[model samples]
Target: MELHALLSYTFFLLFLFVIAGETVWANEEDRKVANGGFRPTKLFVFGDSYSDTGNNPKSLASSWKTPYGVTFPGKPAGRYSDGRILTDYVARFMGIKSPLPYQWKKYGENKLQYGINFACGGTGVFDTGNMQPNMSTQIGFLEGLIKQTVYTKRDLDSSLALVTVSGNDYGAYTASGGPEQGLPSFISRVVNQMGINLKRIHDMGVRKVVVTALQPVGCLPKQTIFSSYQQCNETDNSAATLHNQLLQQAVTTLNNSTKGSSFLVLDLFSSFNTVLKNKGDFTGSLKFDTPLKPCCVGKKGDANCGSLDENGKALYTVCNEPGSTFFWDSLHPSEAGWRAVYLTLRSSLNQIYN
Candidate 1:
């Protein structure tokens, strides 16, 4: 009878242990799936303000102003949005905190476990409006680090890269008085060079490289302001359509040429348009009631979202809640906008998994 009792108690303990183990296993599988696969150990970012996370200096760039990081860190965080930007979400998808910016490398030199962010605001694939390093120079920064043995070949093996060449180049072209007739040809040049940059990153041993399609420029508040921010100019959207079409073809050709077509495209064009129009085939609630209007606006035509008066007072007006608004400024999306955009890219992001 004593032995029977002991055996019964032992079996009950074993049952409990089995249940606990199963629970842990299930949780891990859920985590892996949520992360889209094996979580990448590192992430590298490149391109314009959409991906830039404090890479630009406060002395030059406007990203480090008030109301930018108000929604996230409760202070200015050098991001273009009211909080985190697309790169932050991409890093989060990798199950890692946003990598430190390239400009502040020395501050946390020992914390390269995740990766580095070399993107700068207002920069583009080729030299654009900003004086900051161009896309090639940004890649050069990574190469220099690798050459210095900061990131080993093994590290690059498990790394992921996000490249966001937003419409800064187009803005540059337009600002420089490049003819509207020449726009299509110039877009081809930009995309062709972007394709080369993508291939180069892949060749450098990155496991995956995801590049974003340019969002609808004409739909931005800056463009729609003329219509009292009520409508998007069809002509501008048509130009965006042309860009996306070429980008899709370029990506398809790139994949066809590469073995795994290791380069992937993030369809921001469709996502932005969907959110702007409040209609999409996605599952999430992309119901933006006022997508054309920004959360913050400049008092004067020359001022911007976080602009300041000479008296040091804010020269811009902020919305009651930034999350409710789409654009943080004339160009970048609000943090909430980025969150919705991330959801829209869910189907494409699944390709990141092993």
Candidate 2:
């Protein structure tokens, strides 16, 4: 009887251990699924400057210069603004580090797990203006990786993508003598190409894709400087609204056609407007007395922000505090400005996570 009692006690202890182990394992699995799991071990990015975390060549971009990265990392790490960009913030939200630039092949093995960013500043889907790789060629780079077996089917199944098609294509259109009268038609073409690019990315096996809608262009410092950066041109925002509406329709159609409705749109319009309305937040990073005003400007319209003379003298002047301004230069947002926009996107990301 004594031997039997001892044996029963041992079995009871074993049962408790099994239950505890199962609980821990279940919790881990829940976390993985909630954070998008191991399937997407990488994030493949393609877009313009808004998401370009240093894919542009050093010789070509002034982002490699000083004072561009004075805020966060305390050094120029190739990010366009004072610190992190949309890609970096999104990567953090997805529980992964921002990937290396595709051009930086030297760090390939070390950064392979996170994926790559192929975005080049001043690029668009149609190649309407800039000489950089169009959306298709950017995907070609991804295809080259696959051909080399750098990423497998399983990797893609678990991977996600962020595509940004800022208004560069439209800007290019206007620069190339495309008439304002044909702006609506050109906008449609841009969205159509973007939709095609989305389909191509999905077809290439990325499980989820998030794209940004155009921000308020007229509100950009370059455009609103005429109004002293204190007001947003409703005319430009109206154009953005029309573009976003068409983009929404495109996304809906893509979702209906795709296997799992994987396409998501990040609304930059509302996000930018939110911060502009609030002036600044608790951090005091953006104290925009004149929100549309850019921190740097050319002295005599000789060059835009980041311009340097033959002797390397700066042609533009910076404001007292870049953190106090919404527009970084004439085109992009300050880091603080992007952070404000990121706050507004929290809910949209939640949809993707769910």
Candidate 3:
């Protein structure tokens, strides 16, 4: 690829690494049972790279390259972190192995019992520049599986759906010349579509569907790096705040109208805020000395976490201790960062059983 195009692609992937947050293993028995009566037997994931295991093709996605999954699985496994992500943690919390990625469906028949993941790294609710399937299309893929009997209504009834819509939509919007003054209206549109998507998943017979509220995009290393990794840009944060507020209202409406109110929001904005405020010092145990600084970065401009030079030499620098850094790249979080956020989210996640 030409340098310019490759650089754009890398930056695109970087900005889309939004649900970024895990690393520690909880005791298996601790997650053996849920707090509520409804226990999910399977997990169906949708949205972006945060939950994607290996959906995006290797040739184009950096997640399939070296240094991405170095902290876990011993190599790149299409997870955009040093190790596991929110999806894996959620599965662990439910006492189940992480579901196989949808890309592996034809090959891993026996693993279907866990569920399928349809998330792609550089995707969003709307078609972003990444060219991956949009949220509507991703959901359509699930619908196709149901039509093929890959998943039955009974399977969905016992399943939980995880929908992550971090910041790729906004990334796409801004990149496409969207005006800052018009951001609130665009955010409204995104949240409105998200509500519709949630209802669609529920209509497909999934008893519970959990969607993520927008995280504080301003706090990601992508934005903070411009400030010398010292502070966040409140303008981006205000946009995320608006998105979360609108999403909360939308979810409430969906719940009030649906039977059993199967819709839930993960409150990523609050979770991220808490973790960043504490600098990964969750419960006074976990700590990321440089919470806003990424663990891996390009050696120079336009390079990325996994960038390689023309001679195939690595052009990125990885931290000596990835576990101490919150972000793994310009946008995504390290496993330790995610683990800290998950600790705070565990109580909220337990509500899925209710």
Candidate 4:
């Protein structure tokens, strides 16, 4: 009887252990499902310089000049930053290579399997002064490719699209003599158009679409320069705040109306603010001791990072340690800066799979 009872107790404990192990496994799977087990096979990028890899014409843009891509590819490779941009980091997290730029599509046939980048530097939701294709035109390019069956429905079903506006439209508005009082109205127009663009991309059958909320334009080195790189311009920051609030409302409407939640905002405004506020304290191994100052600047009036004199003499000043600074130029973040931003965005990016 003692042996029998002992054997029964042993079996009962074994049974309990098996059940508990299975429960743990099931819970792990549920976690994965909630976090989005569906991985994207392709990544489509659309935006301005913030996402542009090499879409801009080499001869016409500063991105293709010396000291731009000096950190990563070791030479000018059309990225506006010292290294990779937001798109590259996002693709890496997705376990895919950064998609080829639309203009460079012909160079490699196999690369098309990953995706294509339609972003152009100095371009915006609306046509800016650069004369690059507007957002509407960029979308039309994808539509044309779909028509050609370059990407079948199967391809789009497993794909992701990234759309970034990044304040170029507002820049254009202010530059073209848009009145200060009318700024809020212009911001509305931009976001409304962006909503249409997002829906169009979704209707084209892409599985997931991620768009960026406008970053703090006031915190950029250009605006901060007025404060001797000590503080951001609160007036411009207020406008960015309004833009993000409107964008969030639009995204909420999109998700509620759709069958599934396919549209998401990257919240670049918050990410930038967080990184700037922390000043590399949270970003491991990367320090931005002087977060507001740019690594490169014009040596003289109006000369940009890659500007040259009539005699072809370089007219820009580059920092000795680009990795230590946040902004690479007055306008864009360095690779280190993007890395810090990416860290903050990882949690948000996971929603793509969900």
Native-referenced Cα lDDT, model 3: 0.83
Error of 4 at 320 (Å): 1.0
Model 1 over residues 39-105: C-alpha lDDT tens digits? 4678999988898888889987777888888886778878898887898777655556678888987
Clashes of each: 0, 3, 4, 0
lDDT of 4 by residue, 14-95 (tens): 1111110112111221111222246687899999999999889987989999889888777888999998889887776665
The count of residue-pair clashes in candidate 2 stands at 3
> What is candidate 3's lDDT per residue for 1-354, written digit by digit as tens?
001111111111111111223233455222534333677988999999888889999999999999989988779999999888999888877666788788876634566888888999999988998888988999998999899888888999999999999899899899899998998999899899999999999999999999988889999888998988999999889888888889889988999998775988888888888888888746877787778899999988899999999999999999999988888999888888888878877767766767
User: Regarding TM-score, does 2 or 3 come out ahead?
Assistant: 3
Residue pairs whose backbone atoms clash in candidate 3: 21-338, 22-335, 22-338, 22-339
- What lDDT does candidate 3 reach at residue 150? 84
True-vs-predicted CA distance for residue 165, candidate 3, Å: 0.7
Scored by TM-score, the top model is 3
Better of 3 and 4 by TM-score: 3
Compute each candidate's TM-score over C-alphas.
Answer: 0.87, 0.85, 0.90, 0.89
**Lowest lDDT 10-mer window, candidate 2?**
1-10
Query: What ranges in model 1 sit over 4 Å off?
Result: 1-39, 107-110, 279-287
